[model samples]
Target: MATSISFVGLSCFLLSLCLVCSLKEGYAFEELIESYAESYLTHTFEVSSLFASSICNHSTKANERESTFRVVDKYGPCFQPSLHRSVVPPSLTDIIRSDRARIYSIQARLSKNSGRRDLIVEPNSLGIPIIDGSAFDTLSYLVKVGLGTPKKDLSLILDTGSRLTWTQCEPCRSCYKQSEPLYDRDDSNSYVTIPRNDPVCEYVRRPVDPPRPINLCSYEISYGDGSVSVGFFSKETLTMSAAEKINSFLFGCGTDNKGPFNLVAGILGLNQEDASIVFQTAQKYNKIFSYCLPSSTSSTGHLTFGSQTPAPAGIKYTKLVAEKSPFYGLDLIGIGLGGTKLNIPESIFTTPGTIIDSGAVFSYLPPVAYMTFRDKFRVAMSAYPLIPGPTAAIETCYDFSKSTSVTVPEISFFFKDGTIVGIPGKYSFIEYNTTLTCLGFQDGGDKHSIIGNKVQRTMEVVYDVPGQRVGFAPNGCS
Candidate 1:
């Protein structure tokens, strides 16, 4: 269940007390923008550029110069309102394609092989994928899910970008709606609100309004990408796979903001900005988070929590880079294709900043690598008849009839500490004959490659923000 999108809580403090700042003046605008960006990507580390584009290009709030500290305190997130808009998104065709190389990697990690979740991928009554029916083009990895008073039941997106625990709410101003209304807490027995005396609130930055006892209140949170997630706080009893109840767990009931998504019940923020229940609860028991992404071609992958699993010895372990902590677009780094060394030139690495985005359907690359491969593909397609765009040049299914291989070059990244982050040969290439169009970032190279959920599913990747490190090893996910 979710609260209204319009019902986002702000710490009455920053909004009312602080003087106004403007984006035009440069510094103040840059400060919040930078802070929010870190806040945006802080949770899951998986982000879509569409959010950045929306925030910078389409926002009316971008130019404002001054405001009352009360405004910030009251509003909480100043830029969030303008961010609720349309978000250009990536195609699932590419999403499925990203998984090709990962299958091999997973076999080496978990040791045990398995299938996917029971959730089927078939088209809904509307002829689109069931998951895509929610209609949001933008994805933010919940920046944070909040624990609030007036607890309620909620459904949320388990995301990589945001780390706040939140939920949809009751007793809020205005709100958003979907084909259906927000979640009805009345129907669920699982909601609770952590009281003021609870130790959990100590970790939370309180709202400006002191009386707000970490109540279940959906507040507005905006991402640098110009997308928003509206949710409220509540206490919940989370059950592990084995039915072990993790009591007094605070979480959010996510409500949909704008962008590709029409409206959603709630989102689960896994990023670092605010730290979600997943993080909070994980730490409560001295646990860690890990994931096993599966290729769309095959239906399998697992997102693990606690001490469920760990990477094998000898696999690469790179501490997450924390200095630039805010750009939390997945736990991504540079990869070397075809055995390219870590010290290779920057040109091949694409850029120092890469997005380890789990929500993204595909592993997106900048113009050079994409077009270089596209041209080669085009030359080869000449042998067969091809179509483009609206119509598929070839079927969107894998061409199992023939053997094909895509050998992407290998790459590595240099940490600020002068160490190296490496992605082995298994991650560099992928081949599929069936689908012709999945994802294309255009000739304009994006700042970095979006190492999507597809690649993440292949390994047991641990995102340790406090330690500033990301560890990965092959798994049996695929």
Candidate 2:
């Protein structure tokens, strides 16, 4: 059976830590701002922009001035605190179920051969189709970004596979429940609605008897999970840090929305689209970005735009393959278990290639590859006692409760150009204390394979869009 955890208990736990850290010597004021931002988003606390700005100004270093944002995992301790560390952790069955649902939802969306459409077009230029709901409550990483005049801080899901940044606005025709209040346009002094006379508004169409033209720039976006967001596209001032702010930022003001958006205010798109937040600010940051996802849910990660000085040593580099899909695709040459390479056909990885998505929780591989890898892994772990055959979405699980340490073989991801990245045992297995651990990989059907966030943890993933390459380096993210 699945059980839900309370946010109140979690917030209190995190709040206590934040308070203690604020008084520490090495702790900077920015950490306090981040903690306050998390509390405001999760508990609806009233955090003033002036306070946030003051904290940022105090923490700003002379040489370290750049546009950067703090990224927190949705299930991280800072975001969702655990009641007790020694107590049995949240149900792995529940976590696996949610992860599988997300995978299925993504697969369904990819199955559709919807060709690329023009960015600006009639509302129905691309057929409006209904999506089936399967994976609704998937965990995602969140980032705090400020928008509007007085800088209303909003917690948005950080998505590398999406292109549009959006949030629910006031005067919503219909909207789903969210932890924070809907953004009120009237309160923003820098808010500017796209006028009907603007060329951009011509592409917007309204649903009516005659399909009349919309006076405001409108947009409708549908997700793989059957959730849809529809509203006018407008411009507002976007604030990143105390010193960084962008004017006339294009974003969707969702008036009607639905689905398991979780507790976030909206989605922040990081795809390579022209209108994406990353692209819009690329020039300012020199088209460079990197993120280090923590291995454990208790640690907080960071996402930075622009250059990272003195790049981490011994970084593995791979060319970013160009694909029609709005994801970062790479040629997966092979996968290795321990020191032995699996004799799987390379053709299985061609059709859909492999996508490295930060939003996905589980790594998915072609069925053949998955089975081969699983069999090899099982053989490698023959020494350990097998606990169970199946548990929800996970087929293989083990009981390490009686043992102090388990020796699991290393899993390696072989990419093109002879670039090999190995995964340590700690990363390959999901440890629920000293007892329970499960394989982090899953079967992603025969069509597509995805390198989910789980496998990408503790690695500094650098997406150099302009350079057309992605680099990976080991980092202690947890």
**Runs in model 2 lying further than 4 Å from the true structure:** 1-65, 80-112, 116-136, 196-213, 389-393, 431-436, 476-478
lDDT of 1 at 26: 70
Tens-digit per-residue lDDT, 1-478, candidate 1: 1454334333444554343534345777788778765432111111121112211122121122111000110011222322353323324443232222221122212122322211111111001122433332322221111222232223344456445544444443334553223545454566665555555545444334333433534344443223444444456655432233456666644444443333334555555543464466555534355554432221223445554332444455564645333324333333332223223245544343554645543455555555554454344334333444422421212222232433222234344334444443233223222433222222223444556553453455666555556666654343
For all candidates, the clash counts are 123, 0
Off by over 4 Å in 1: 1-155, 167-183, 187-190, 194-218, 223-231, 254-264, 285-287, 307-310, 327-335, 341-344, 347-352, 364-449
lDDT of 2 at 55: 15
- As a TM-score, model 2 comes out at 0.75
Worst 10 residues of 2 by lDDT: 49-58
On TM-score, the leading prediction is 2
Q: Whole-model lDDT for model 2 versus the true structure?
A: 0.66
Q: What is the C-alpha RMSD of each candidate to the true structure, in Å?
A: 25.4, 18.1
Which 10 successive residues of model 1 have the least lDDT summed? Answer: 67-76
lDDT score of residue 442 within candidate 1: 26
